[model samples]
Structures are given as C-alpha cells and as structure tokens.
Target: MKTAVSIPDRIFEAAEQYARRRGIPRSQVYAEALARFMAEQESDEELTEALNRVCAEVDTSLDEFGRAAARRVVLPASEW
Candidate 1:
C-alpha cells in the first residue's frame, strides 16, 4: 500500500541514512518502525487488561491492609 505523510527534515534524513546503511528500502524501514510501535501498544494493552482482571479478583480489604502495613514498614526517602 502506498501512503504519503510528511516528516521533519532531520528525521527524514536520519531514516534515509538508516535505510541506506541497512540496504533496505525506505518503505521497509517505515513499515518495521510502525510494526514495532503497534506491537508495543498491543502488548501494553494486554498487560493492563490482565492486571485489571487480577486486581479485581483480589479482596479490597486485603489490598488495603497490605498498603497500610507497607506504610508502617517503609521509610520516607528523606529519612533513608
């Protein structure tokens, strides 16, 4: 698929240099960058969903008690 979007001159120059050095098409470099970015976003979304599920399953009282205990045992950075 063909797409056109403008980028800063410096970033364009750098990406061109990167593509030339790696002996790959400029389109391939942009494609890989987008692919990696999308993958990271998906991974982060999945992790957040899993964490929310687990947190919802745990007892709120237990969680609050742990927080209270941590407050008692943990010292302020200034004190440390």
Candidate 2:
C-alpha cells in the first residue's frame, strides 16, 4: 500500500537518520513505529484503567501503597 503523508523536516531528518542507522528502509521504520504506536495506544487505555483501580484501592490502604513503593528502589541519577 502506498500513501502520502507530509511530515515536518526535523521528523523526516530524524527518521532518515534512524533508518540509516538501523540499515532499514524509511518505509520499514515508519511501519514498525506505527505498529508499535498503535499497539501501545490500544493497550494503554486498558492499562491506565487498571492502574486507576489500583490507585483507588491504595487511597484506602496506606500499607499496600507503602509496600508497593518499597518494591521499587530508587536508583541514583547517575544510573539514569
């Protein structure tokens, strides 16, 4: 399928660079990105809803919230 879409110069340049670095055609890069983006969009809505439910439960239980926070260790900025 062939379609024409106009993109900003900066975005085009970045995509071209990424395609060159990955040794793939620009179309393939765009296709992969679009697929990933669509998948995320489809799943994010459900994930967000689940997270909201969990957060609502946390509001009623500080212990649960504390345990959840403790499970995630904060790393130093240098690691990032």
Candidate 3:
C-alpha cells in the first residue's frame, strides 16, 4: 500500500535517523509511529469522556474539578 503524505523536515530527519539506527525501512518507522499515535488518540478520547462523567457526578466544570481532584491526591514531600 503506497501513499503520498507530506511531513515537516525535522520530523523526516528524525524518522530517517530512527530507521537507520534500528536497521529498518523508513516506511516501517512511519507506520509504527502512526499506529501508536492513533492508539493514543483513541485512549485520550476515552479519558476525556471518563473525566467528563466524573465531573458531572461532582456537579462541577471539568477545569475546576480536575484541579480539585489533583489536589486531593497528596504525596509525601519525599516522593517529590
């Protein structure tokens, strides 16, 4: 499956370097990166939905509730 796509020069350079270092074709590196990116996008959508649900349950806006939730999870000073 051959297709044409345009990417930034810096991204192309990094992909070429990765392919050479791993001894694989540049297409393989691009394919794997695209797959990972798609998966992460899907995960992010799910996370957003879950966060929205939690916010609704608490009857608060996402921004306000997310910060409050973060503040609740206190870690010892040593952990920092």
Each candidate's TM vs. the true structure? Answer: 0.74, 0.58, 0.67
Worst 10 residues of 1 by lDDT: 71-80
Tens digits of lDDT, candidate 2, 28-79: 9899999999999989998999999998887555486676665565433236
lDDT of 1 by residue, 1-80 (tens): 99999999999999999999999999999999999999999999999999999989986564777878767776443374
Candidates 2 and 3 compared: the better one by lDDT is: 3
Segments of candidate 3 deviating more than 4 angstroms: 61-80
Tens digits of per-residue lDDT, candidate 3, 1-80, equal 89999999999999999999999999999899999999999999999999989987995644876877667764332365
Cα-based lDDT at residue 19, candidate 3: 96
Which candidate would rank higher by TM-score, 2 or 3? 3
After superposition, the stretches of candidate 2 with alpha carbons farther than 4 Å from their true spots are 48-80
- Model 1 lDDT, full chain set: 0.90
Predicted model with the maximum lDDT: 1
